[model samples]
Target: MTMKKLERFALIAMAALGAAACASVPTYVSLDPSLPRAQLTFHKGYEGTGLFSSAVQNYALGADEYCDSAKHAALFKNVSGTESALRVTPDVRTVVWAFTTYLNSTIGAGGVLGRYDDCRNAVIFTPARNRNYDIRQASTNGDAQCSLVITDAATGAAVRNVEVRASPDCIPRTKAARGSNR
Candidate 1:
C-alpha cells in the first residue's frame, strides 16, 4: 500500500477505537454561571458511504490549543444540533472532528476481509460571549483536503477571522493506557 493509504488506515483505526470508547464516554464540564459563556451548534454533512457499509463521526472540544489526539481519547456527539446544543465557556477553543467509513468482512459482496477510510480535522477560534455559533466541516480527495466553517447563527454569516485547518499527523497512544501492563 502507498503512504496515503497507510495514513488513512491509521486514522480509521483511531476513530474505530474512539467509537468503542464512546460506550463510556468522558463527561463534559458543566458551564459555570459566573463565567462568560457561548453556545455552539455542530453540523454534520459527511460524504455518503456505499451500500452495506457504515459511517461513524464525532467531535471533541479542547480549550486554548489544537486538539492533541494523544490527550483526547473519546469522540463526542455525531448527531447535529437539532438534537442538542453544546454550551461552552467563551475562550479560545478547538473543535476536533473526525469520521470513518468501513465495510465489514462478510460472506457476500466479494468480501476479501474488511476495508476502511477515515479523515479528521479541526477549527480553532475564540467565540464571543452570549453568541451562538454553527460549526461544520467537509473533506475531499480521500481526506487529503478539508475545510470547516463557523457561522453566526442569527445572521447566517461566516464567523470573521476563523481558522480552519487540517488535522496534524496522528500520534500513537501510550502502551500503558492501552492495557499493556508491561
Candidate 2:
C-alpha cells in the first residue's frame, strides 16, 4: 500500500477509537418529599450487545453514585442540613452487583431480553419508608441513560430529580470526596 493510504487508515482507526472512548451515558435522580418516609429509584440506560461490558458497568456505577449522593442529601435535608454517614441497603447493593454481573456475562444481551429484559427503565428501589410505596421506571428513548428518583413516604410526592451524564470517570471527584465518610 502507498504511504499516504497507510496514514489515512491509521487516522480513521484512531478517530474510531477516540469516539468509543469518549462515549458516556446519562443518569437521572429524583427526590420526593411530600410523604413522611423517603424513597429512591435508580434508572440505567440500555446499551447495545456490541458495547463492552466495562462500559455498561461504568454506566451502572454512575447510576449508583447518583442514588448514593441523593440518598445522603435527603437525609441531610430531613435533619435540617446536618450530614451523617451513609449506609446502603443490602438489597440495593445486591441489585446493582447482579445487574453488573449480567452485563459482564456472555449472554448479557445488552438487557434486550424482550419485555422482561428491558433495562432502559429500572426502578432501583422503593426503599423502606414508613408506608408502602411503589416506584417504577420507563425508558423514553433507546439511547443510554440512567436515573434516580426519591420521594416522600407519607404523601408519595417527588422531592428532587437530578440527571447526570456518565463519563469514563463517572461521578465527579468532589462527590466521591463527600462520600468518604461512608
lDDT of 1 by residue, 1-182 (tens): 44455445545654665557454335456477677788877665455433323345555566433223323322332222222356777765554444433333223455334555556666567878899888765543245455666789999999886766544333344666546522
Candidate 2 per-residue lDDT over residues 122-178, each given as its tens digit? 223324534333222322223344343334435768633323223322234465666
Residue 104, candidate 2: Cα error in Å is: 17
Clashes of 2: 24
Q: Give the TM-score of candidate 1.
A: 0.60
Backbone clash total for model 1 is 0
lDDT of 2 at 87: 25
TM-score for predicted model 2 compared with the true structure: 0.23
User: Which lDDT values do the candidates have, in the order given?
Assistant: 0.53, 0.30
